[model samples]
Target: MGRNGVDRDRYQASQSCSDRFQGAFGAPRAEREQQFSKFMEHLPLAVSIKDKSGRFLFANEFMKDLLAADDPVGKTLGELLPPEEASMMAVNDHQALTQGLLLIQNRVNDTYGDERIFETYKFPLPMPEKRTLLGSISVDITERKRAEQALALKQQQLEELNRSLEQRVQQAVDELRQKDRLLIQQSRQAAMGEMINNIAHQWRQPLNNIGLIIQNLQLQYEAGEMDSEQMATEVGKAMDVIAYMSRTIDDFRNFFHQDKERQPFVVNQMVSRSLDFVLPGLKNSGIDVECREEPNVSADGYPREYMQALLNILNNARDVLLERKVKQPLIRIAIFRENKRSVVTIHDNAGGISDDVLPKIFDPYFTTKEQGKGTGIGLYMSKTIIEKNIEGSLTARNVDGGVEFRIVV
Candidate 1:
């Protein structure tokens, strides 16, 4: 055999004897080293060991793959990473080894233009050689960090959108409410105008009657032939006229004061009251008014306001028939209970509304009457009172010969 080959065999024999002696004393050192090497090689996380000088003593397969190095053992960190990063890692590693403290660091690494994040734990491994660190484990956390950042950004965007949407929705609701208030005010003004017109018509005949009676009384007194029975009868007639005027004023006051309070009332009574208020105008216009008695027809809603709406419809019918100068103007009101619903119908014998105007009749500020005479919100207010306040339905349709309004509560 050659001299070199003989020397190598001698060294192997001596190492085997030393291993057997260590095994005889306790767990074999060579066996323990072999098991530890195997465990480190198969570990999922990167593992490395460094001496107190910060030079690499050992590197496992995972560490070699992370560093992209074929032979990492005995290499210094300066050779594996940039100067700045290597210096920082060396300082941390030396401090951990000397103080016997754990060092944890999360850092971003950029090598070959590819960026990655790592979480590293440097722990002091219990070793016979005090200056040597036996374990340093690092985990790559690039994907997890990116996912968390993405989620935070999405949450922020969603919160911003929600705030914007809430603002827009609130603004729209405010605008609609404002429009509703304006419509109600316009309707109230129109109703007042109609009431004034009716009042003028009612007072004309009564005032004329009073004037005639006063003239007759004056003539009798001047002639010195005023009989006691005749005087009493004249006084009674004057008192009756005053009482009728008083009732008319009281009805108007009640209708205008509907906002004072609400009470559950019979729907039929409200309809009757509305008809009575407008009966004077209807009579002068030669229009006949009729209503069906329905004792059980009642509602829990605002009775006064609803009655005002009904009165407005009846007044409109009277105005239309008077304008047309119909030979036989007729207004019929009917009330009935059906399927837990109270239904009211109002029909008039005035000419039916034109097709072009019927669709927009309920719209605020839309009217067929002369501009100065119509405020044009009566039907609109009635719609609001029926749908929003009473949870009811109101609809108008042209009949074969006239117009009809139907309400259901």
Candidate 2:
């Protein structure tokens, strides 16, 4: 009973083991093959299998649709695609068969008239007869390629725009700097001309006095009435007049000197120096000048530039006074401290600026004077000097019976 029972149990166990092996190796293998074939047929990629001779052994539905072909099995790539595409695919197939496996990326036009890109993975499939089949799976990469290209183009455009913008900004800055330089140069020229005119006016009286003194000295010496003491006094007087003229030249030179750095300067000194430049002309024009100052009032700036600004204001005032020929013409300058800032006001009794012309007075090249008499750069340059160089403000307004120019530094 034991031996027969043992034999029967062994047979049953052997049969059960055999069935389990068949299920594990056969059933699942077939199921997986079926699943893979269905996946390849429906996948969103072109799948193909070709013999080493480039004859199509299999083609998935996607491949057939891509080529606009019906049945593709047993057909060559040359029969299913354009000559160019077929030749390219044949070369890849040959490479896969000879080189074991190959990867290729190419572009083509689909049957639907759309451009497409594909990355194909091609490998050899070993057959029972030692023949090789080329297996290929290619995904449509058209959208990805297009997106990458668009992004590259956009990046290039942005870079170009940035470059153009930088160039334009730099050009604008350069042009502005040039304009500033021109304005400064022209203003200096105008001030120099005025300085020369003042020098002439200042020299006139001294020259006339010297002529009178020399004539008298010659007359006395010829008449034998010249004494040593009288000669000494007369010479001393002539020397004093010459020294005065020399000092006047020095004052003019200093006023036009180029100041390279900012320094604290007394407001009254700056005013007096500027007035010294035009004093003779002011007196010649019968223009009475009055100045009042608050003690210790000082400003930190280029003194020459400040003096030039003051000269511009004073000259403008003098011009207005003479042009209008107002009775008892007068220019009044006052300097004081206001809100921790040095303030200067120059006003003249030349009938206030017309309301219509007031607002544009400070604009470059704007002037009420007739053409050729005024360059119109004086006030504009003055404002530029105060605001830009001195970090100050200059404003003008009609006060009492005249125009008043105010500078705050």
Candidate 3:
């Protein structure tokens, strides 16, 4: 061999081939050497030989391209790569030789940004002159590794989904158990925050009115102007206000119930009911809401959750209006039949969402509001309610002056 590279050992390893074909196969040393070069150069493999110090002694065309090297002889792997990459390659090289079948996997992006995975078979090759070299033969294996990973991930996801399904089935009352339970739980939690704020706003006026009524009763009794009829009249008025507050509680509580079966309900009436829950808070923020509905428009689904989704959208609208502080904040709601499907559109003039963020608004746990001010799941739950629970489509778009969400069921 030339330059103390392969020498006597390699020639002897081909002795049987020489014996069989003699002159035709290996009689001429130059012809045998040329054949070896041609085979290695054309082989569809990353074939390379490196000295003990990792200096490249020989590299085939495939190996040269793989290393991004036009010429690799005399240069070490360290010289061919950046310091950190060289270090990583060195560690991987050592690990590959120690592995079963000397299999080494490399994950990196190609020049075109496509991801590639390479599995290399690495080992040591002893040569003449008491020298040992590192040898490796790597095929593409990118597609193979990707397919194996995809299959394994698919299997893992199925197992995880099955476990999650079993757990949800045991604890949830809803027939749909694709973590409908989790969505319901988190939805209720998010709604509870808005409910409390609305309660504080709506209760303020009634409580203040009650306080004045009590003060008036004390004044009348002190002046000897209190009569049975007068006393009862004031008491009844107070009772009516207390009853209204109780009904509000009932409205909020009933929304949390899981529906057992598909039921028909007036779509407009449900929309008005949802408004009752959050209109107080919206009005307090000076955010006017206008709702228009066509007669006899109805839907067949979990109406309560549908209303909850409406509430979520309305609450989101209210928050946005309050945040942006538009001169004239308005939320418009319209319910009608479109393409024989019940359609509800809620729109608000809050200056609309940005292009970058509008697409991800319905994605779970995606919110632009400051921490503690917004639970990103608001719109996600709204989407889950319409698409999953109600078997419909929920979509949003930037309108002329605001964002409009359309729910079709």
Compared with the true structure, the alpha-carbon lDDT of candidate 2 equals: 0.84
Model 3 CA RMSD to the hidden true structure, in angstroms: 17.7
lDDT of each: 0.76, 0.84, 0.80
* Ordering by lDDT: 2, 3, 1
TM-score, structure 2 vs. true: 0.62
Q: Ten-residue segment with the worst summed lDDT in candidate 3?
A: 9-18
lDDT of 3 by residue, 1-409 (tens): 3445443433433332333344566447766766766777798888776655666766789888777789877677788877887788777666544552477677755556687777778886644565555677778889887798999999999999999998787667455565667866888887988888888888899899889889999999999999999999999989998998888888878887878888999898899898888988888888898878898798899888888899899988888888887999999999899988899999998888899999999988888898989868878988888897778999999997999999998
TM-score of candidate 3 versus the correct structure, residues matched by position: 0.56
Q: Across residues 370-394, which tens digit of lDDT does each residue of candidate 2 receive?
A: 9899989899989999998899999
lDDT tens digits by residue: candidate 1, 265-315: 798788877776677778877889888867868877888779867977887
What would the TM-score be for candidate 1 when compared with the true structure? 0.64
Instruction: Provide the lDDT at 192 for model 2.
Output: 90
